[model samples]
Target: MSSATSLPIIFVEEGALAAANLSAAHRAWADANGFTGQRGRLLALPDPQGGLAGHLFGTGPVADRPPLVAAQAGAVIGPGQFHFQGASGDPTLAALGFRLGAYRFDRYRAGKPAPVLDLPAGADADEVDRLVSGAALARDLINTPANDLGPDALDQTIRSFAADRGMECRAIVGDDLLAAGFPMIHAVGRASAQAPRLLDLTWGNPDDPKVTLVGKGVTFDTGGLDIKPASGMLLMKKDMGGAANVLGLAHAIVSAKLRLRLRVLIPVVENAISGTSFRPSDVLTSRKGLTVEIGNTDAEGRLILADALALADEESPALLLDMATLTGAARVALGPELPPLYSTDDELARALMAAGTASDDPLWQMPLWSPYDAMMSSKVADVNNAGTGGFAGSVTAALFLRRFVDNAAAWVHLDIFGWAPEARLARSQGGTDQGIRAVYGVLKQRYPAA
Candidate 1:
């Protein structure tokens, strides 16, 4: 494996030094520089002319799996392309980490260009590009403020994305939502001047297996009539993270030209406050024809998703997956990095768990416990938007969405935090695209192209 565009990357872990394999001159240079192979440590050797030379990236042992902090290579190395010179676990994942770690949401400001990677031997360029691009798109969407990414803007985005790929796309906006039977979506979004809408994009042959994905697209959550505290509302802009993740994964599927028919449904809305905002105890009819009493307006993500999921389930797709920043209890349960997955099918659960682990986009499985079903029972309607008690909030939310999904061969609901509360080695602090890459990895394995 030789490349002109990329510099050589040598990975070293603590205890076992890989510097020993380097030429005596380079090894001596590394030792002179006090490079000890600790994780995230980088040593760049200079040529005698003080020009370009190779680099050393500190990482976990070779036996450890990838997504190893190879991202540090991008962060530390100067502008240029690079390739792996030695085994650092999975080269593909290492490349992905490098790309992801190199990411910067500089939409509003000018930033320096980061180092690039020459695709390594055995690494699929398309796969790595698709995954990194998907995550990058999601991160950009989430990081953008609500003022610029409202429901109407999101609608235009879906249209533009579909147009570029020659996919069928449409939006049922404002009052049309009421006429189309998506009452919950309209109810949640109607108060905003922006108007609520459902954005739909379809691709692939009709004869192929159907896979429908639904996302909660609340552009901003003011908590409607039941307002959130000023502190709580600060990060409300990322309420649309579910929509971002779906679009990201959809991009991967369509770009890779997978073997399944794909449909993306996003109920775009803004849970804003106004005189017309839906009130607490209000009974709203959903697309599924189920009536839900508003237990708490802040629990609005599930309302919009309920209607969209009902619409998607009507097709009895082979797979139905919905992602949402739906519950704080989920963050409490699994924290921000790991999204909780709810699914009844053990096989699908196993596959998703395996894919998530392998891809480093981890999810913890949470049961759709039937006992919690009664907790959402409403005195005035078919169901309550939220549970009466705070306990098992995430579980009850998953169960609530489950009612709208019966026809799909398999249904998985992801309760995702969608925001990284703080920064990590490769990931910057703020809105992150959680669980999507892992989901895409599963889809790739399940529906590989011929």
Candidate 2:
């Protein structure tokens, strides 16, 4: 695509290509040029002086697709300033998607530069920039291989990231976690050669509304002693996606200076196989002093989160949020795009859904069903890591996590898939972090800096 800044974009719907308000000459030119507005089609018109007249981008019905569909046009269109003609959707979302669509990893290989696009009229440039930066940083982190981003590396990454922004960062590694009383974290991570650690980051005024975010940082899941199938291990690198998302959301919050004391807790570990690997049927104590029996060591994400969540719950922050690539049942129920959200408060859930809808980062709310809570009961311990029944795996996981949370005014848990199985307009087919943007939206609404 040519990097010409003067090109204009004509938004055409599949059902209204011919009926759109186009001039006679341009309409005739479009018809002659065989532009039918089918999705992913682009048509360019030439002016009398042999310069570019304008561009035609085909899109689906306004209600059928997400606002980021404009990202497809952004990906292919000429590098230039583009002003939409006759588009009826939110211009701000379109611009945001356009900027997102221009992303490429290119860490190990060089790629073409992204074409520059001017912010659409009435769009908040600063907001778009923040989101794009946060999301891209998260995506890059998730996409990195586990070999390059182990528990130690992840800790250093968080420390460096927070240090650059002047946020206080600390971590308790190896045997230190045991002395710190984070037994579940130490138990789950003891098998890996790389030591397990808890990464803590804090920022903002102590007197402000307290908000805490906890993320599962299992760097790689070989499923511990209850190993996953060979196929299942392929994407285990993304198990720490929750940590990446929290970092991304943290970036957005701190950058925007939202009026809240923010704390990020991540229990970084590698669930590797070794002589000392935690076994299925082993009972481990947690920071909260709850005894959890390991029905399946593969279900380790929640075990680590149990200790971290207990720590976060101690303070009773105003709002507590935890995200994890926790359960496959979530993907079976809602598929890849819609992450499942579980909240303790209805008002908080409603607000989050509204924010997600408003920001085009929607999530589906699932019940924290108490009936399934019994499935996690253990004869030898207070609770079992794996459920007795195979059904409602996602719900059972949420219920187990809920057991660790108390005293917070509002708490929401998101079981995110954290990977895009296939490529989309703005998202490449790799480690794709979900639900953070919507969460950020809700946070901004509830606690915007004065």
Candidate 3:
């Protein structure tokens, strides 16, 4: 649509409405309407003919306003083509937020059509599309129910994704997991009707710098023999959010055609209760030859991730990253919006943090805290899968996974909630993507297109 016909979105900073550069008539209208530029406050502007002309959106104060605050416009605007007239925030992030805010998970129900937003000037269209596509894929996968997205289903989905991208994909299933030295993965998922599997996907030029990603793929966490309470099981379907998010990040990297050899490892399983369910105190051998004592069957995400991380480390990739919805302690430490990042490399962590701030994906760095490693000691095995004191649950989980990595050049781990407890400016109240955008931003910087 032409700029003349499209609705213009005029952003107003909080407490600056009086000096908002509005025409005398429009200013009078805003004053009469008591528009104070409160965050998320939207006021419709009219032309001389009493017809719709534009909209006034409050961005709140500059100091506290988020980069994606412009996303609020996408959520509130009706069906029409709109463009930013005088937005003061980062234009690229604003445009990206506008697109993200228009996202909806309507697979099981009908929803309204999304309003169109003309791409703002200076925004990279390709980059925006890549990020949006990745986020949507992750959200859709996380939002799917367990009944339809079990281990086998997840395996198939990954295979299809690989095929579409021309990536080589393979899976080692059921008894094959044991044959392949993934005893912990088999033990954790053996009880379920759906067999456990480890999915591997490879893409890009093998001669390029190796970048490996591992994700915990517990499709549905019933907590096995240590079943979770009914309230905890309510959102168990999202247990595989880690796998979903990594795939989303992978998509962005491939779509951008970054110069790196990418490898993705996902240990897919369902922590279900059955006659063959793995019990607490069972010592299971991992892919890396370390025996892990199951302190609590509910702590199964780390178990599967340990095996995958071990496999990734074996290649000694230049960069190793893993994402998981691992511990409740992480949530207690830093709510759902901010995922905690743990890295062996300080430079990598700092880069990720900066990228998160710039991309509006926000990540907080949490130390690996080597002192907490003792909390996972086991009397009968190499290590216990759960913490002893329960004081540093998240720290101990990160420490447990660290035991399996010895060869990677640099490694980073993200403990993400993967769910939005409440609706926000650019995010819905359901499954969402975390940390991927920040990681992608860093990747773009590290491995820019040739």
Best by lDDT: 3
- For all candidates in order, the CA lDDT equals 0.86, 0.87, 0.90
Q: Please report the candidate that would top TM-score against the real structure.
A: 3
Task: Return the lDDT, model 2, position 231.
Answer: 100
Error of 1 at 84 (Å): 2.4
> Model 1 residue 142 lDDT?
93
Report the C-alpha lDDT of model 3 over 86-144, residue by residue, as the tens digit: 65477778888988888889889988888788888888889889998899999999999
**Candidate 1 ranges beyond 4 A from true positions:** 1-6, 18-20, 23-25, 32-34, 63-65, 76-78
> TM-score for every candidate vs. truth?
0.95, 0.93, 0.96
Model 3: how far is 144 from its true place, Å?
1.3
Candidates, ranked, lDDT: 3, 2, 1
lDDT of 3 at 174: 97
**Poorest 10 consecutive residues of model 2 by lDDT?**
1-10
